[model samples]
Target: MTSRKAEEIQHEGASGGWGSVSGMAKVLLREKPTPASLDTLLHQNKPHGFMCTSCAWGKPKHPHKFEFCENGAKSTLWELTSDRCTPDFFAAHTVTELLGWQDYDLEMQGRLTEPMRYDAATDKYLACTWDEAFTGIGATLRTLDPKSVIFYASGKSALEQSYLYGLTARFYGNNNLPDSSNMCHETTSVGLKQVIGSPVGTCVLEDFETCDVILYFGQNPGTNSPRFLHPLQEAVKRGCKILTFNPVREQGLVRFINPQNPMQMLSGHATELSHMYLQVRPGGDIAAMMGMCKHAFALDAARREGGEDGVFDRDFIAQHTSEFDDFAAKVHATTWHDIERESGLTRADLEAAADIYATAKNVIAVYGMGLTQHVHGTQSIGMLVNMLLLGGHIGRDGAGACPVRGHSNVQGQRTVGISEKPELVPLDVLARQFDFEPPRDKGMGTVETCEGILAGTVKGFISLGGNFVRAIPDQEVVETAWSAQAITVYIATKLNRSHLVHGKASYLLPCLARSEDDVQASGSQSVSMEDSFSHIHGSVGKRKPASEHLRSEVAIVAGIAKATLPPNPTWRWDEWTADYGKIRDLIEATYPDQFKDYNARMFDAGGFYRGNPARERDWKTETGKARFTTPTVLSAVGVGDAPGRYHLITMRSNDQFNTTIYGHSDRLRGLEGSRAVLLMNPQDIERDGLHVGDVVSLVGDAGDGAERSVGGLTVTAFNLPSGCVGGYYPEMNPLMPLWYHDVDSKTPAAKGVPVRISAGKKPT
Candidate 1:
C-alpha cells in the first residue's frame, strides 16, 4: 500500500498532546492579543465566566484550570487580536480591492472599529455613526414587507440576544428568522422532531460517565469539539467502547492525550478511543445504520429461538415507540449485498460492530454535519434513530441520540424560536405578551433565503453574526443572489467575505464578541447560552471590548426593533437593553414550560438542564409516543456513480472554527499552509493515474444542469474509502450546486457533491 500523506505535512504524535499545546501557543504568539485577553481563558467554559463561543459542548461541573481546548483558544485569541479595521484602513482600500484579498487576509486585517455604510460613489465603506446607520437601516426595513426581509442569526448568539433578535423579527411582522441552524443541524431538528418529538439531543455531559459505548456516525470530536475529548477519555478509562462510521478515520477518535493531565502531557500518553472503527463510504451512514439494525433483528430472533430472553429491548420498544413492524420490515427488505456495496464495509465487519453494540448496556450515538449535510440527510438521521430505537437507547440513562452541534449557542438560538417555519414557537403567546399579531407566513431558511434572493423576492438581509455567504453551500448561487438584495446589514465583530458581497445598500455594524465585558446600566451583565446537551448557563465576559464603538448583540437588536417598529407599551427596549435579565424573563414567558425561573435557574452551578420530553419518554408528537420513521433511500446521499465521479465531503481544520479560518494549518491531519487541497484515497489516485501534489479541477453536477467547477486544488493521498474524497469547505463550496439540497430539510448537500476530477492549471 502507498503511503497516505499531504505535500507538506507535520508529524504530530497524537491529537491534543504537545501538538495541541504548540498550536495554542502558536495562535497566541501569532495574534499577539492583549495579556488580559489571554488570561481570560482561565474563565472559558467555567461558571460565572464567558462561554468558549466555539463548539456547543457542555462544560464540566468542575472544570480544569484551562478548561478551553486549542481550537477554543484560537477562536478567542483570533477574536481578541489587537489588529483593528479602522476607518483609515477602509479609506486606503476600496471594496473591490478588499474583495480581491484572501478570506484569511481580510479577517486578519482585524476587527471592525465602528459602523460603516457603503459609499457607491467612492466604492468604499465610509465610517458612520451608530444612530445614522441604525436610522437608515430601520427606515429601509420599514419600507420592505416582512416576508421580503431575512432576519438571520449566527449560532454564537447568546440566548438573550437570540430571543431578542427573534422577537425583533416577529415584532416586525414576519417569521423570517433564518439562522445558522438552517444550514447545519436542521436535519437533526427535522429528523429528531419527527421521531422523538424533540429537536434537541437527550444526553447530558454527565451521561458520558455512565455510558458503556459511544457510536460516532459522522462526528469528528478532535476538530469539531476538542473539549469533547475529555469526556471520551474519561469514558474509555471506565471501559466504555466507541465505534465510528465515517469516511475519514479521524485520529481524534483513535487516540487523544488530554492537555489537562500533567502526567499524560509529560509522558505523551494517548488514550485509545474507538474499539471498532469502520471507514464507511461518504454519505453511507444510512446503509451502515440499516445493516446494524438488520443484524440486531437477526440476533434477537436467534436468541429467542434458543429459548432464552432476546437481546432486543422488547418492552421499551413496545411501550415507548410505535411502528416497530414497519421499521423492521424496511430493515429486513434491505439486502446484505446492497448494504455492503453502499456502506463499503463487509457483513463480517458490521456483524462484529453489532456484536459490540449488542453487548453494551448503555450507548450514546453522536453525530455531526457529516451525516446532516447531504441530499438524504434527514433520512440518514431517521436510520440512526431506527438503529438506536431497536436497542431501546432513547430515554435510557447514559444512552440516547446526541446530535453534536458545531456552534456554542446554535441550539439555544433555535430554542428561542429563531426559525422560518411556523408552528415552532407559540405565536399566540407572543401576540398575547407583546399585544401584536405575529405574521403566520412560512418564511425562509438558508436555502430558501438564497432562493428568495436569487428570485429577487428577498429585498432585505440582516445577520446577527456569521459569514453568511461563505458558510452556506452553492457559493455561486449565493454570490449571484446576494447582490439581488436591496439592503444588507451585518452585526459582526470581525471582517469577512460576506461583508464584501454587498447589496444595493449595505451597513456593517460592529458587535462585542463573547469574551468581552458588556456593562449595561444595570451592571456588567452576563449572557446565557444553551449547549448541545440542552444545558443553559450564564456566561460573563472578563476581557475588554475589541472597540469602544462595539455594541452588545442585545443592544443592537433592541436598537433595530425600537427604530423599525411602532412603539408598543409592552416593548421595553430600554429596560431589556439595559438589563438582559428582563429579556430572559420575557423568554420565560414565551417558553414557560422550558424557561421557567429563567433568571434564577441559569445561575445554578453548571447551569440548568432545559430537559427534553423525549428523554422522559413524554412524546410531544401527535401520537404521544416516540415514532419509528421509515426511510425512502438507505443512503446518506442519493447519488449514483458515474465515470471519474467521487463523493466529496467538506472538512474543517483543527486550526479553524466554523467559517472562521484561524490559519492555513491542520496539524492533526498533517496538512498545513493551504486549504485549496483535495484528499483522495491512494487506490483511487493510483487507478486514475494521478500523482500526489498534482493540481486538479473539480467539476460538480447535482443533475441540476448547473455544472459548477473550481480549479487548481492540490490532490493529496489520504486513507479514505474508495470513491470517496475530502476537501476543505468554502474552497470546495463553489463545486456544490446551490439548487441541490436535502428534500426534507433543505440543507445544502455539501457532504456528498457528485464531483469529477481532471487535470487543471494553477490559479494566476
Candidate 2:
C-alpha cells in the first residue's frame, strides 16, 4: 500500500458529499461573480431549460431539485460565463504565438465571438463576414474530390444539428462522415450490433430499480457520468450488488454521498457502491470476462450432470440464440492458468465474481472507454454481451447491456447518421427522398483521416464542434497532417489547440452554446437530443446568447451545406434552418420507426423512448437470432514481454470533460496545480529505485519501430495492480502509436500503452 504522507498528490475518501458542493461552488464562483453565478443554476436541467452539456447520463423521469453533478456544473458554468474572446484578442496574438500556450490556458481565453479567417501573411486571424467565410470554404471544396473532404462531428450539438450535419455530407456525395463515437463507444456499437442486432444498449434508465447485480467494467461513473450514481445509490439501498472490475480502485466505485441528500451530506455518510472491487490489469477486461464465462459454463455442466437445474437459460438459448456450442467450446478451451495470468487476478477472484453473477436473478453489464479503447476492445465488449446472453439478460425486466457513453449525445449522433460506415436502409431512404445517388464508398474515421492526410489524399477538414487535434491519438501524425491540408474550418463555441494549427484557408466560426437562446426565422426554437437510454427530449436554451454575432450550430451547418452545393432542387437548406421541425421531419422520413413522432414527442418533460428492437426480442440480424462469437485473442495487451515495461492507462480528471480542462485540480484523485503526472504501484516505485516525486519519461515500447516519448511526468506512488501505471490523457497520447489500435473497430488502444520508465526533467 502507498502512503500519502510523503507524496505531494492527495486523494480523499470516496467521491461526492460536501466535497462535491465545495467543488460546484468553486467552479461557479470562478466563472461567475455575485448574483449571476446563482442565476446560472436556476433553470439548468429543468423542464424548459437547457440540458447539462456534459455526459449523456439521462435525466430521470422525475427530476430532483438539483439535477446536475459537480463536473456538469463545471461544463454548464463555463459555457454560461461572461468571458468572451473578441476579434481584438485574435488580432493581438498570432496563431504561432498562441500555439505556445497550454490547452488549459488556450480555452481559458473564453468563448469565441465571431467569424474569423486565417491570413498566412500576418499569421493572425481577422474578422470576416459569414458569407465570405462560407464562400472560401465552398470554393476550396469544389476544387477537390468529395472523397477528400472530411466532415468531423462532435456530440455537443443537438440531435437536429447532428442530423443536418450528416445529411449535408451525403448531399455532397460522400459517406466520409466521422464523429466522436469513433474514438470512444464505437466498439460498443459494433460489438452489440453483431450479437443482439442493435448498435445501442438494450437497457433503460429505470431498469436499475429492480436489478439484482450490476457487473461494472472499467468505468468511473463518478467523474464521467456522475448522475449514474443516483441509480447506483438507489440500487445499493434496494440490496442490488455492484461488482466492479477495474485497474485502479477508483473513489467513485468505493463510495458516493449524494449532495442532494441533506442527511447524507450533513452527516458525511456515504453509500458504499461496490460490493466487490477487483483490480484487474490495464487491458485485462477480455480475460476477466472470459473467466466468468468459463466458470458459468463449468457450473452449468456439473449441475446438469448431477440431474439438477443448470444455471444457463437453455430454453432462451435454444429459441433466440445461435452458435452457443461454438462459444461454449471456445470458453472451455481457455484454461484457468491463461485467464489468471492475463487478468492479473487469482482463480478465486474469478470464481467469487462468477458466483455473484450466477445467483443474481437480474444482472446488468455496464462498461465505458476503459473497455472500448483497447487493442481487442470489440472482443472484450462482445464478451460482456456473451456473459449476459448466457443467462438471457436481454429483453428482461431489469437486466441488459448498459454502455455508459462519454459525450452528451454521442450515441444520438451515430443513430441520426453521422458515420463513416452507413447502414443501407438510411442510405436507400435518403437516396430515394433526395433523388440523388448517395456515395457507397467507405469514408474515413479519425485514424483513417490522419492516415489519408499523411498520404496527401484528404485535404479539406470541417468540424462541427470539439478539440479534434487534442482528443485524437498520435499527436505527431495529426500535427504533421494538418499542414498538408488545403483548408480547415471549425464551428465552435470556444478556442481549442486545433484552431491554432491552421491551413491555407482556415476559418473559425463561432456558434451559440446549448445554454444560449437560438431564434431562427420562425421563432425561438428548442433543440433535441437522444440520451444513452435512447430517450429523446428537447433542450430550450433559456439564457441569452453569449454574443450577438453568434449563430446556432444548426444554422451554421445549413449555411455550409448550401454554400457547398449548387442550389439543388430537392434540398431546402434555408427552410430547414428557418424551422428545425422540417429537418426533424426529414430525419423521421429517413428512420421512420425510430423517430415515429419526432416533433411532438421531443417536447415531453420526460421525453419518449426511441425504442430498441433488440429490447423487444425482435432481432433484426441476418440470422434472425442473437449470435455468439469467440474472441480471436487471449488478451488485449501483452504481459511480461520485457523488463521495466509497464501498461500505462490514460485517465480523465474530475475537473475535466473529454479533452477540455476547466481547472488544475483533480478532486477525484486529490491532485492540484498539475495535469502531467504518472501514477504507479508503491512496490513498483521501490523496485525502480524511485521516490514519490521523481520525474520520469515514458518511452513507447510497443516495438513498432516508432520512437515515441513523453517527458516531464512526475511520478506519484499509489495503489494499483503491479506492472500497471496511470496518467492523464492527451498528455500521454504521444506515447500511443497510431498503428497500435483495434483491428475490428480501428479505435486507438489508449487504455494500454506499453512504456518503459526513464529519468526525466521538468519542462524548463
Q: What digit string (tens of lDDT, one per residue) describes model 2 on residues 244-296?
A: 99987778988999988889988888899999988888778888989988888
Model 2 has a clash total of 0
| lDDT for 539 (candidate 1) | 88
150-214 per-residue lDDT for model 1 (tens digits):
89999999899898888888888878888888888899898889888998888888889999988
lDDT of each: 0.86, 0.85
RMSD of each: 1.9, 2.1
Q: Which stretches of candidate 2 lie over 4 Å from their true place?
A: 1-12, 33-40, 305-307, 638-640, 761-764
Q: List the residue pairs that clash in candidate 2.
A: none
Give the lDDT of residue 219 in candidate 1. 84
The candidate scoring highest on TM-score is: 1
Model 2 lowest lDDT segment of ten: 1-10
